[model samples]
Target: QSEIPMQKPFQQVKELVMEYPVSENEPTEENSYLSYNLVVGDSLDVEKCTAFEVLDYVLLSEPGAPLKQALLDAGLGKDILGSYEDGIYQPFFSIVAKNARPEDKDRFVDLIKETLEKIVKEGIDQKAVAAGINYMEFRFREADFSSFPKGLMYGIDVFDSWLYDEGRPFDHLKKLGIFDKLKKEAKTGYFENLIEEYFLNNTHGSVVVVNPKRGLAAQREKELEEKLAAYKASLSPKEQEKLVKDTVHLKEYQDSPESQEALNTIPLLKREDISRKAGRLYNTEKHCQDTLILHHDLDTNGIGYLELLFDTKQVPERLVPYMGILKSVLGYVDTENFTYGELSNEINSRSGGIYFGVQVFGNAWDNKKTVHMLGIKAKALYQDIPFVFRMIKEILGTSRLGDEKRLYEIIARMKSRQQMSMASAGHSTAVMRALSYFSETACFQEKVAGIDFYRLLDDLEKNFQERKEGLIAALKELIHYIFRPENLMVSYTSDEAGYHGLEGEIRELKAGLCTEEIQGEPAVSVFEVKNEGFQTSGQVQYVAAAGNFAEAGYHYTGALRILKVMLSYEYLWMNIRVKGGAYGCMSSFRRNGDSFLVSYRDPNLRKTLEVFQKTGDFIRSFQADEREMTKYIIGTISELDTPLTPSAKGSMSLNAWFSQVKEEDLQQEREQILDAGPQDIRNLAELVDAVMKQNRFCVIGSEEKLQQEKELFQEMKYLL
Candidate 1:
């Protein structure tokens, strides 16, 4: 194991420098960004260097830290990024300023440097340090270990310890010791000294400044094609034949079935290990006032989770897009009494977090009905329940919507984040767009916050000056219609005592909301399936083809769930990911009977769609033995059995309630899944055949690839 020396903290320093212009696809009106990555080029000794990790966490978590304050003052947010290994730690600070001019780049860099220097000289605030320590302690002690597979986590920790040559895997006692050591070290000037040695005076660092440049994508594409052509020309005939042979061999290997012995060798949960009974179920109680309150009693240490779901059925369809805007900016903008920064600090210091979003779910009782909720979720300690209530009230009642500068900043930030997401999660967006065609809820979801939402945001950002008044007025109108006590449904999760104590406070808060009643339900609109292609700068494509079985009178069954597992593991994995060179692929079946076959980070769009279209044939021909069926059954049960954190569990329970799904329904579903067999699997093949014939699909990919097959799509759009 790597050891840490008690003395001589200054080590060798190395520097790596690189400069790159931004891509042609990125918005480059005036924004340029700089990143600094300070890496400790040494292996960490977990036993001895736990204090160091804690110190790093403290520095990162303290929102009131000098460096963070400085960055915020410069209209930038400090995005700290890091990874740790047995003996290596790499932590860096990424400061992004969306509206930065070229002239501001050097000033931002100098400010960052000066902030570090100040940290080295004066150390962090004592109150901030205390808060960090408290937060870390709570995280360590109150973490939900059941959220993931305990056995898998244990095996990973053991393997890591063995790889590092540590004596043993970490346990509760060892962890407590580390925490104790961290507390002691935090009281001294230890962190300041470490910062000075490792960062302030250290010469080992790199500064990466990325500036926006037009046409970089086209230039790079040309260079790549030239390189490929030259490589092809240089290849000998024999070498080319051998390369073809190697590719054929790889395809064959991926297609070949694994030996029984090999399959048995893999770690898997046995059927006996699966529980037949439902796990812990929440005890739900409802209270009525102007709004309905749904309460779930679950042990949450001393923490409380509160959620307000406002019925948005009364909101006009035209205001749906603004709901997304409101969700993004509501808690982020200034309130009547506090600036945005002050609100942020207050929330961080007093509570865990407060946020808002719109949630759409298909109604459980009625097939044609869908529940549209504007949800406000917050978390806080039991003692700070009043503060949570106050914060929620302030956000809903006094949040400034007409602050044009702040509004524009929020739009720019949201646009930037969405653009970044396209490169990584385009598959999700594609699937959402494809599914939007089948149902009113799905269509509304797409318009509100899917790929269509991104386009709306882009237009708003580019033409903000022209559309400012209309946008603000629309937002105000949305607030007027949706933010009413009559439309509210309150839900909370906490220990029994905490719930009882905060019940009256919550009731008082609900009573104070706007008492005006909504007159009528929002008009629902129908949309046709749009077989579209979205062109982006992403190197790979995200392909999705979906069909709503419910619309065709096909209800969700356990057979469909089992079929999903089989197709995802065998058919999709082998065809699209393993053989087609995609990063991943999945087949999802929703309870609402919306199913999607999606390929992620895929190299081929048309070919991936072809593979999806052929799924029916694959399902019809699939032959699985008893062992294979048992394995899939166990896998499905394992997924169903995965535990959730208190907050997550509460939210899930509330959603189930909204959907009118009872515990009995879930138990029956579990039984159905357990009883699923070969016949059940065979029955789903016909459904797959039907779905493929419907031919609803969407593809998001590079402009080059998308344009190459534009004829395959009904409409083509550019993301940028």
Candidate 2:
């Protein structure tokens, strides 16, 4: 009796537009980072200009918005595309107004800034925010991790899939996704915060204004071309050959005294520290004071570690990333410095030639010796202070997508080798573990690991031809990926002279007592700060904040936290991880006395500027939004409730029973999550923003990128 009707094939994409006027600033460094444009003119025909709002940010219009054509007739530019680079992810804007007077620059920036402020002040439409939140929730709830690989691979191929400059595959993928029922049974309440996190912290975003600096632009382009050339040469021989044939005007480097000098400085690991607890190894050390504290975790019949870190005062900042790369590279390539093929050889030799492997940050790095490799883990060791800086640089410097070529090559070899070895009954986990551990130790996090220095030399040799374009393209993505504004570390610190620069910058607290009818009844008060500086400073670049209050008794003989939710994260990683020798480190923080300090994991006592700088930067930069909160909350909650495997649960329960982490602590941790609100987050954001402006960052990588990018390092305040 019922007829099923087909639904329409298309749904309307809704967009909201907000427009405002802004005054142009003098292009100071402080505001340079904010995308703004400079326009030159003798006078303003304010009536014939226009502006636009793209994504969530403001933009001036050389080209007005499609629907805002009417507004452009009143005085705005007609093009918004000038400020944005095609194919990049960041939100951007442009400004071009005709007949604007030379004196109008300041007025323009001011007008635009004011308009932006008004937009922010007027706030996001609650209804819109809610609908977006709900839609995201629905999408995530319905997402199937199973389809991720196919979807992601298809998306990646989009960059190369164009035929005759026309993109047909994009539509095909979308249609197939729906028609083939890959997107069916969609749920609407999963983790919507992933999208939120992407929007707020992606590196693709930038603010661009037209500047009359041809020299600067040219210099940037030249440098970029060189960098690009260097990167392309690092791929495999097949890829490299392809790049050469496909690209043009590529430059290559030659063996030069400058590079030689830089290469000579990287040092070898010279020490180790070991301790025992409860009949198991508890601590391990390497490369100066870098330390790792091990806990015999029953979960994997292995260990978990906590790293205690220090600043980079003991090491060079330039060397930090270089060393990391070297650690990874040296672990693999048979080294001239050591006989027996470095650690892999050593393990196979020790185990009568079995298999070996190394793992970095949970990913397989040296899978070649999988047969003889048993197990290995390696991560950088640094202090909490500049940990953020280290993370930023490390993520930026390393290849994204885990260098899929390397992955495939290593995997294929391992698979084939494993098959042959299995036939001989020679494949043993012990042998493999030994090899992996050895590589993990010798080559772990070396500066040269991910770099194609040899390729750069090859590119340099080619004299800017045969593979320049691909190299340049790769370099652009790598540089932009690493240097995206989202990676900048921000933090707060009082002046060494003892000035609380942030004290009055934020709104004062509005704490008041609430009492019952009884005159002596105890009461509670609500305290909150207004814009003494929340969103203004821009230091707390990643997170948002806000606050609110409810009635409670103040004199009820109960102590309350003035700064209830002071937040901190695992700052730096120490040598808690070692190949075949140590495990990963875990840090714990418990609220203590007046000022607080928590557990840290790191070995080196190297407390340098890089360490402190990065730590503060990370603290200042990280933003806690709904998505972050959801992921963290969900992941943690899931972990907490996860049943210990049959073997581990009993021990975990026994330990919890013995330690103070029984039901109460667990309940408290959960309650902390429940008690959090949006305003409290906003308040914390402001505090972080205020502190980050004056902080310094330290680096501690190797000789290569650092030496080559010294000028880059010079851009920041460096100590030693």
Candidate 3:
């Protein structure tokens, strides 16, 4: 342990392990959780640090990595997540066991240590290390920062060393040479040594177990009420009087408008300064034999982005849940040519990755129609395009999908994730639920991803044995029905050279494509449940109220964008966030007339809805000076002009086509947004009143809170 060289001496490793036990209100859908983080030393130098980066992908982050497989095999949790966080001075390795039991916390730690010990003794797999090094280098070299600015990412990386060390602000960015050196050193057992130094022998680590407790949020609320009541009881009469005055004064201050002089001092981009036209993404539809190709020829730095869209109308509504399970099954399932592990490793070593999902897009021209497309999205460097196509062919054509044991694992993991998403961001769930009463697009969304999807996962997991055969048959039936070339449409984004080469790849891929006829009649979706309460163990609530203004005899206009800004920032902000003490609130009016108001992390359920109910009054009395109005217009335009990557632009163009949105429509909307006035806002009062008057709403939050206001809901039940 003392043989390693260092610039400075450090504390000796402790003999005992440190364990931190934490308790929190977990979603009723999941159990306890544990995060086993081992202190894996610091970013003192580049070579060792970059090696750790590569080790992360090899160990757990990459799909079907050995560590993830080990944990899954041990039956510790449904989904195990592992990551290497180097944003701080001292980087640590984290292994999270989701949907874990409290009693299994020690087992998680022990299993992690055992896994690393075994790796150290038997040596890290050379294949994994090679794949890991290649992947890390590819990501850094590509330098695609998602949607964030490149300089911003670089600045954040600079902090990795600037804050801890006095010198070398850009130390972390010098990874190319270190990565190359580490790849060569891998054959010398450099990574195995790291495993020994950091994990097997390192005692400066902690096992954090977060135990879930039912009714914790309700208990805490009662304690807070008691504490506040006692504090007020102890206040003197004069103090209480002053308290009332102070609170009134605060509200008055909040209600007051900003001074014109102060507002004028802020910089402005006048209406004439910005463009009135919208930038349309490149879309030139071309036809190859028996398939539609949506070619978005853009400069993607020699990387090709491909999308294979197959219409899902042929898939009966009952099989929608199985579609989600199928997304997880493909690539992970054993193919005719390759085992699951080999397939996953080959993917990581060669190209970016392949993903499959069923998407629902609302028609821009008609709200009743939906573009139900099952898409195969993938990316690869120009040179690796052939490999990507070959893999896709094998997965769609030759993959076996009826494995009972494997399907059970996939379904269990999805059920855990469904519960987490509803707990963390229930606002989306609530809004979808509210809109599902009328909008077919929203209805389809609810079936695939909303609470209904969660129920499907729950049912399958609960009775896997009895339903295994049917589930397997459904998977097979869907695969044959979905992968047919009859309805296949392709979207490709690449440079001119790559674009030309795509036809050949598609021609080869076409041979493997399914072209079977349907054996049975497809059934339509049937489900309607609105004005419902979704109960969760979360302390706060996500309250949503939505209605279709179109159905209410109201037409959509561009002026509504400015009105949205006012309601979201001025009215809803003050009432729901500042005064009501909720974390956030939003008001949105879409062109298709689907308007919704949603609250995030809100404490009071009824008060928030009451605020939504008064939204029409706020719009009717809307008032603002010209200068203040310009700010709202500028904010809306800023959102419209957010930066996009080439691939994103390509995907957006395809989406717009599917949704039936025209460039002229976008331009008109921008012009109206720029020219909107106080009258425009007042004119929207009718639309707001129409949408809010119906009172179709859904809430997901504390069980106790939902029970207190149970009359607001037609049905109340647990989310899972």
Clashes of each: 2, 167, 0
lDDT of 1 by residue, 108-172 (tens): 66786788677767765555555445555555556646567555665665554454446544532
Better of 1 and 2 by lDDT: 1
Model 2, span 1-720: residue lDDT tens: 112232222232122222221112112221121123322110111101111111211122111222122223333321112342222122223433322233334444445545444434444223322322333232232232332344564575443223213534343233223322211211331112222222222233222333222134335546888998888766889998887765442222211223545644743221111111112211111121121212222322121111111111122223333222222332333223332123232321112112112222211112111111111121111122132222222322332323333222222223323322322221121112112222322122222221122223223223444534443344333233222222221112111221122122111110111112211211111222211101111000111111111111111000112122223222322211221111222221112111111112211212222332233344445455453444334433333444333123333432342232335444554554444444434443333333223221222222222333345232321110
Show model 2 residue runs off by greater than 4 Å.
1-326, 333-669, 682-686, 692-720
Q: Cα lDDT of model 2 overall?
A: 0.26
| Candidate 3, residue 356: lDDT | 88
lDDT of 2 at 49: 13
Cα-based TM-score, every candidate: 0.86, 0.20, 0.93
Q: Estimate every model's Cα lDDT from 0 to 1.
A: 0.71, 0.26, 0.80
Q: Give the TM-score of candidate 3.
A: 0.93
Give the number of the best model, judged by lDDT: 3
Q: What does candidate 3's lDDT look like per residue over 1-720, in tens digits?
A: 123343332354322222222123334334566777766677656676788777887887766677877888888887887778776556788788887776776777788888888888888888778777777777787777877877889898887777667577888898888877887889898999998888777766666767655556667779999999999999999999999999999999988977878877888888888888887867888888878898898999888888988887778767866787787788888899887767777876788778888788888756677878888888889889888888999899888787677788788888888877887788998998888877778888888788888888888987999989999998988887788777688999887788777777887887777776685445465545569997876678999999878878888788888877787888999999999999999878876788899999998899999999998898889787787788889888877887778888898889888887878888888888888898898988888989988878999887888889999899988775
lDDT of 1 at 252: 88
On the 0 to 100 scale, the lDDT of residue 59 in model 2 is 22
